[model samples]
Target: MTDKAKKKREPIFSPEDRSNLRWLWLGYLKKRAPWLGAVLLMILIQGLVYQQFLSMTESGLRVIFESGEVGQLVLVCLGVFFLFAVRGLMSYLVPLVTVRLSNEAIFEMRRDLIGHLMSLDLAYFERTKSGEIIHRLVTQTQQLGVFFGLATAGAVRDAVTVVIVSGYLIWKNPILFTTAIVVLPFIIWVMNFVSDRVKQAQGQAERALADYMNGIEETVNGMRTVKIASQEQVEAGRLMKGTGAIRDLMKRVQTTQALVMPSIDLSSAFVYVLVIGGGGYMVLSPDFDVDGAGIITFLLGMVMVFDPARLLAQYFGALQSNLVLLDRVRSLYDEQPSINDAPDAVEDFDTGGDIVLDDVTFSYSEDQPLFEGLDMTFRGGQVSAIVGATGSGKTTILSLLSRLYDVKGGQITIGGQPIETLKVGSLRGAFSVVAQDIVIFNNSIWENIRYVNPEATEEDVWRAAEDAEIADLIRRRGDAPVGPKGAQLSGGQKQRIAIARAFLRDAPILLLDEATSALDQATEERIKAALGRLTKGKTTIVVAHRLSSVADADRIFVLEAGQLVEQGRHDELLETAGLYSQLYQAQKKGYDGR
Candidate 1:
């Protein structure tokens, strides 16, 4: 790769990376220390028992050949059986403990990841794909648990077994054992080479999988649009591209893993051959000191050593493959939320004071400014309306008030206190927003309304539903599921449900973003009355494209190209013959033409 390409690619974690992932692993270990300690103890006992079994087998053979004592052979057999029983129990307990530890750690980590994602600013969601986030939260997290289980628990057990078995071999025949283990360094070198490939392939595979998931998510979410546009083939082809990329990357990863395992096995077999040949020469030589039984023990130890060596090799390969996933997950955890509470944030918001937007300068991007030093105020317990053409910073103003995005310059205050000084939850809790785009979950209408006020009584929910003019429709559905994204409901019905939610909240402040735009004329008029009833004696800000809707508002603010061009009552603004008048006249002419 060129230097530019290398710089563009995100660097995967290496042993030398020394990132907070190390601390994350340490924290998990500390949290599950009891389970970890038990697993380690069990592994140690299992290793010791395995070594004892091998020794007892050798002793039994020597007793039969040299001592000719059947009774002693029986005792040796019984000792081996006892060791096998203990090893079997330890093996079961170790895995049991390790699984428990893994589950607990995965649970906590997932909870923390979800909570962090929830606390993140809305801007993050706007830029990120839901499918990608879901993959990290679900699939990668599970893989991380498996990696932890193998890397820490499985690796330690296999390592202990190899150490014990190798030590026994050296004690019996140092020269032969040393000669046999000489092939291990070559195996390590081969594994290291394969590991680098695995790491690179694994990262590509994860990205491909994430892309595949994104395609699936989009296709599923936009099925209606795809069908209406007759673009099934196009979407399928796009999805196939994602799947093909994933397939190729996975093949590379699997090929690397497949080659590594056999290479390690081949090297181990070669070492066994060397041990057998060398030990045979020593036993047959006149000057040799070791006997047949000792040679047999050395050979047995070599066989035992190979099992763990192969296991460790496999573990290492899996560890390399999963490290890429671990890095992705860790990077997500390290992300800092752009919006957070101030150090001295107020615990509560005084909703009685007017909301003042003073010289508020803001922009979504540096080149395209949305609002520049804009000033406005919504008096306490009064309904104010913002009217403008599309992309004139109407809804953007509401977003600013809610602190979904903070101002780039100047300040916004409520009740004579700067909004940044108020706790995010408390500030948001002061207002109930009914936005243009309503989000309805696959839940019953009652639950959806009660989501904003979980403590609300049944009567209170019904009251709010009636006030929002959705009670009759919900009564017909009863507790029926709304289907995914409220597919079972009509657009106007979904809007009414959202309004019902706002009514259930009954907060001191209200924000309506084209709240009744989806309704028919008759339904809109009825909802307008309900809204008037709902907004009585509350600070309300409404963003409407329909100029007639705000004719009765206490004050109307007209925006043109992100700047406030007119501010007054509806008739007063029309008499001024400004941007507001032009928009009102156009809308009135359109209505009259209809």
Candidate 2:
């Protein structure tokens, strides 16, 4: 190996990765040390028993072939048979314990990974692709699980067997022992060569697979749009391209792995030839001081060492390939949630009074600030609305109020308390949000409704459903699958389901974000009625692009390019003939034209 390659083998992790390894060792491996130790002990016993069995064979062969006798043949046969049984048991237990230990650790790691992902702020997920996250969550861990099996089975058991057999070879005949292992250096070099390519190829293959999965998720979720636009062929071509990329990358990975066996075989064949030729020459020469049985035993020991040594080589190569997966997983684990409770954050803080954005400055991107020194408020115990053009920062205002994303500057106060000072859960628990993009899980309506409030009784769910005018949906669908994102339901139906969830939440504050924007006039009328009841006697804040929806709002705040350009009751703003009036008039003209 080159010096660079040798150096590359020393550090599995960079300096940044050292912190993450502490978690793997301290959290997972250390916890499994007892079981791990027991497995190693079992492997050790099995290796010693195997060596003893080989010695017994040498004795039996000497009596039959050279001495022309059959002393203790029956005893010898029974003893060898008993050793085989013990060896068989060890084989079963070794893999069983090793796999179980790995499986449990992986199960816990998965649980922790999920919990950590949930704790991250919305911005992290917004910037990240769902496909990449899923790949790391599911696929990376699975690869590690398989690698652990090889690390234990090949590294430990095979290693112990090789050591014991090699020692016996050295004691019985040093010349034969040295000749038997002449191929070791070549095998090591071959594995190192394959390993360098394996890491690079596997990394690319993993990325390609993630992209392919992401494409599947996107196209499958947007299937309706594909069909509506008559772009099925285009989507097919896109996916075909993705699959082709994955296929080529995998071919590289598989091709590299495939070379391992043949390379080892060639070196092994050389060892077999040298050992056989050398053993025969020794048997004929009295100067060597060895019997026919000794020569036979040396040849058999050579046979025994090759398989384990071959496995060890393959294990190292596979370990290199899987290191990327391990790094990907560690990268995720190392991510700290950008939004978390402060050191002195208060959880028991009360919620009431106006929610004021005190000169708040924020942005989704650094170059273009969405809300700069912007200020607004929704009165306590009253329904309010914010209206604007598409890029007017309407939805962003709602996100800030709910603390889904923190403001870059200034402070937001609820009930006269700075929101950042309160625990995130306590702050968010004060409001129930129904967003433009509603999420419906792939489960029955009953579970979907009840999940938000696990303690809420069945009757409570049905009542909330009735209040949202969706009781009939639950009654009819009852336990039937909703499919992903509620594909089985229409837009109006999904809107109603979100409203039902809000009603069940019954938080002190209500946030209605374009709830009725996507519905038809008839459905809008129904949803408006539901919203009317939901907002009663609560601190409600509504954001919408449709001026008609917010026309009757108790107070209207009009935004223009992330600035508060207008605010008042609807008729009051219209009479002023400002930006709000222009928006309302334009919308009115469009509706009239339609």
- Using lDDT as the measure, which candidate wins? 1
TM-score of each: 0.95, 0.95
Q: Residue by residue across 186-211, what tens digits does model 2's lDDT show?
A: 87677777887887888898888888
Clashing pairs in 2: none
Model 1 reaches what TM-score against the true structure?
0.95
Tens digit per residue, CA lDDT, model 1, 207-284: 889878988998998999999999999999999988889889999988988887788778878887887788888889
User: In candidate 2, which residue ranges exceed 4 Å CA deviation?
Assistant: 1-22
lDDT of each: 0.86, 0.85
Q: Name the lDDT of candidate 2.
A: 0.85
